[model samples]
Target: MDNYRPVSFWFDSLDDPVLDLREPPAQVDVAIIGAGFTGLWTAYYLKKKQPRLQIAVFEAETVGFGASGRNGGWCMGTATGIEHMLSVPSLQAEGIRLQQALENTVDEIERVCQAESIDCHFARGGTLNVAGTPEVAKRSQQWVEHLHRLGFKDSEYCWLDQAQSEKRIGLSRNLGAYYTTHCAAIHPGRLVRGLAEVNRALGVQIIEKAPVFNYTRVPDGSLLLSTGRGAVRAEKIIRATEGYTESIQGQQRSMLPLYSMVVATEPLSPEIWQEIGLTRRETFGDGRRVVIYGQRTVDDRLVFGGRAGYYFGSKRRALIPATDKAVKIVEASARELIPALRDPALGETVFSHGWGGLMGVPRHWRPCVTFDERSRIGWAGGYTGEGVGASNLAGRIMCDLVAGEKSDLTTLAWVDDVPRRWEPEPIRWLGVKSIEFFGDRADRREANNQSAGIWGSLFNRFVG
Candidate 1:
């Protein structure tokens, strides 16, 4: 296999090399700086809105090669820091409205996939936020009640008791779960690669292996995107690099890149699946403060992952081995959650693939979909691991912003809410490390039937 294939199970499964190595064009009306979901979706909507506009997407690697291609494949309806937005009276209404729009975005993705004939293995199985302990169960119920208080219908968010949740998913100690019909499981590789092809058909030029090392406002007022191979000048530049944003010159602290890892099991036998449950293929989560996510593949494989630690200095991974320490941690979590995974009959072989990648989190933990008229630069990202479906919405809003249209998309809270720059150097490193430490300790305390205590409180304040 090539180097990119080892990035994730989804990437490894693709039949094509997905290498679009053509050089970028000299000049264009619009220049996008990544071939991931954000850039591709932005291009898709732009072409749909204005077919005559010239657009080109430049990527550091192949399509979906970053977090878009290597994420846990969760097309969730909720964006990070949304609950925080709901806490304010002024922003609450807009937050609810955003949630509704995200729900529609889920269907929109399926619609686009069907219309474009992209078989990304998209499945609307929803999600089960499982509770492993009585304390967590109580907390989970309180959360559901809070949602109801905020006018969320049961169809949108509801609670399932221990017996009900266990019936749906046979987790080791599942006390209950909060189910939401706003998330889906998908093959990240297929979705991204397909979107790139759709953009091609729409006459959008995509150039891979062309990294935008820097950009500046030229004397002529056009932005100059400089790359190793060449440079391009455009009237508008879209900075769509999510987790890898810092790689460019003069953008070191724009967004923080945090690493997450995953391991997927081989297609299991019917008997093993019976012991495992998740027949509907609903995505699973135990609400660990440390953060864990999983899904059952169309091929009967168990794809599982969780927090893979923050690398010092926000360094990102290219290709990870099956034996990586972070991969082992995720594998252990999978077995701990699902006893079927630890069966003696299954023997030593269980997980088939393991990989890791980065997700961008802003200093304020909010997403940004905005355009600056003066600079003529529009960008969207800071999803904090919610890029799958959120990127679709980002694209639509970006289209409006880039085209100078004053539509609903351009008026959302995030349209002008670019995150603040990350703290510099050792402070940034220490803060990230401390958060991970507290998160893990909090989960451990909860497992022991104690409150998350100071550790949990600290984590909530920092991460939120």
Candidate 2:
């Protein structure tokens, strides 16, 4: 097979052309930096809520060239638990509130697509969290219980016993699994392209190939963003640069970028699909140190992804077909769960595309929306690898902030700037690797205990 190319199964059939706003006007009412989900959605909502507001978005590269285009398109509600927000009770409440608000983001996305006539391959078949080992099953059970305590009575999530899970997911090696009906998969690239079209139809200016160098608070209370070709002066500014936030200088440099990678397989034959039995358009992931996530595409291909390599590097270097050891692990895990997958034909399945991108993760995993009243600068980031839905909610909150609406969105506590210190450069380079190493050890030990059935009682005691 040829080396993995950047083939977007999602955008393959879409006819929407890329937006070219290379030269923006001198000023606008609202200026958004970064043209991913956050930037585009922010512009969309701002126009919806305040139609008269002149909005302009500046993208460093082409739109959706960032994580928004290259992520594992699972648009589930909140994935990160409240553990990250327990430190601040107020923020914790807001996190829960935002989580509730976003419970239907997938539905909202579908609604928008249908209304705007955007042809994104949208499916609502839910997702499965497969447990490779007993330890993973134990954790899945605990997570389900946690969701119960959080008052999730929707019956969307159910625990499957070994036999049931094996029959349902075609993964006999799995100890058990937790299934949720709320999650859905989409072609992320196509979704972004459609949203860009919708935004343009609404007269929002999207400038691509226009990298913003810096922004300053003008004496007249408007902020001026200096770009490579030209500058945009706006009444308010929103920073939606998720992983690329670190590239910004000055006070907003506290954010750190985390890289993640994904790989997609060549379309499988009907016989292979019959053997796999994963035909129900569901996404699956096993709870491991280097978590593996995979979903069946509409065209019967399996797209899988996991954590990036040990070092902090660019996507071009870190996430390629040759360097995709993580994808191999996922492919192996797939075979392990489905004994039929051990066939040489299945093992030889070529990956069509492999790519990676960065997402911003704050020391504390809570999402942040801050307002600088003096300069009218607003910012949002720190999605911690779960920004698909959070970014949509963030765009709404950002619009509310711009409109000066004193709703719960503005009341959400913004993360105070922590000391801008990362693990020393060399150490930082080794950070992900270290986590992978230790996290694997912990998971393996837990799996061993669970397989022996001794850990269940212990975990039950802890839960009780």
Candidate 3:
């Protein structure tokens, strides 16, 4: 248990450390892999829909051990590539429904937390996309306009001038802000842990430390999931292993695991917080090309993230830096955004914890949720580091799909939209590394007031 604390700061800060382990039964009505949010949420909703269904979630590690408990705590009602996905003319109506559904998903999570009596420090103060640069400010203005033109009401997305932006959160540079009321900052550790408790209360068998090696289909049409202990047969199986999809025998190229590192500052004093805003716990980030995000914890800690990379062939055991470049980069960025962090009077280092987690990015960089009626083998994943709220939405969608119920969610564009397999080994590694490298170069070039050059242009086209 003590060793698990080093995995991430959220795990280390968990107040309820007690864990319940169960053995996978001989068979179940539904067998879900991965005990993270997607798997657990799917189980919870499934049992809610059909109380008599015997469902079991098989986890390789303890509950919330994956990205669910180690994320940036921004439960934003958005997904990767959402803007582009919704902008297409044919998808306009469906996009509106999808966007509205995602926004409601945030409220759905809040409702669950309240109804279940989970105190996860959830505050829907919204998100502030700080335009700390003049360049970003113009783009921010254009973005809000684009949203309005796309049929989104002003209440969904609004622009703030430099003064209004600073009033919400004291970000440096002080140009403007792209604000939205569709985001909430919650303690992910508490949310995932609380969900587990609720699942247990609702009769969802959570088998911990049961790593599934691979799966097979029986002659009778049932799915057999093989573990070190034994094979557990089920009528249906759902794959929820987001970034860890590579661990599955034939899924090495299905989802690429992108690594994102994070760091958190010690709880600040009132004086320090006064200098650096975020009184409502609004999640904040800039329009940087490389991407970055930060949230003000309920207890006054600055939990910031966005140092990212991609490994070759999605290796599990990575050779990490001794003095993590992520920590230094985050600390430097945070200090620049909030000068109070650089106060010499606060001692040598204000950063108390540092950690990293993997996000599953599909080849097309869009989230995928599919259920094949014929095979009885369905999977929900490809969140690309933005799965927090999407997972909840996915749980509901997957439930409807598994139960054979039709709704607005089942026919969305992402459903059954399986991304093509990534190119083989060296090509995959080279392409991913190229994107990583060019992304970095683009950010650096912009910071130095230089053009991104041809490489950056090609990188943008490839990523888009």
Candidate lDDT scores, in order, read: 0.88, 0.69, 0.84
| TM-scores of all predicted structures | 0.97, 0.86, 0.95
RMSD to the true structure for each prediction, in A, is 1.4, 4.7, 1.9
Instruction: Give the 10-residue window scoring lowest on summed lDDT in candidate 2.
Output: 1-10
Q: What is the alpha-carbon lDDT for the whole of candidate 2? A: 0.69
Tell me the tens digit of each residue's lDDT in model 2 across 1-464. 11112434343334444448557989899889998888888899889988888998888777777778777888876545344443245555655565566667677877888998876567777777888776678778987876666666647768878777776676665787888877777788877888888998898989987878789987877788998768678888888887777556653335557666776778877777776666567777776655667778888787777764533442233233425566566555655655555568655666566656676766454577765666788777677677776677777777777787778666654433333445545665565455555555565676566342433344322211
On TM-score, the leading prediction is: 1
What residue runs in model 3 are displaced by over 4 Å at the alpha carbon? 318-322, 345-349, 450-456
Which candidate should be chosen as best, given lDDT against the real structure? 1
- The positional error of residue 159 in candidate 2, measured at the CA in angstroms, is 1.1
lDDT of 3 by residue, 219-269 (tens): 887889997557899999999999888888899899888888788888888
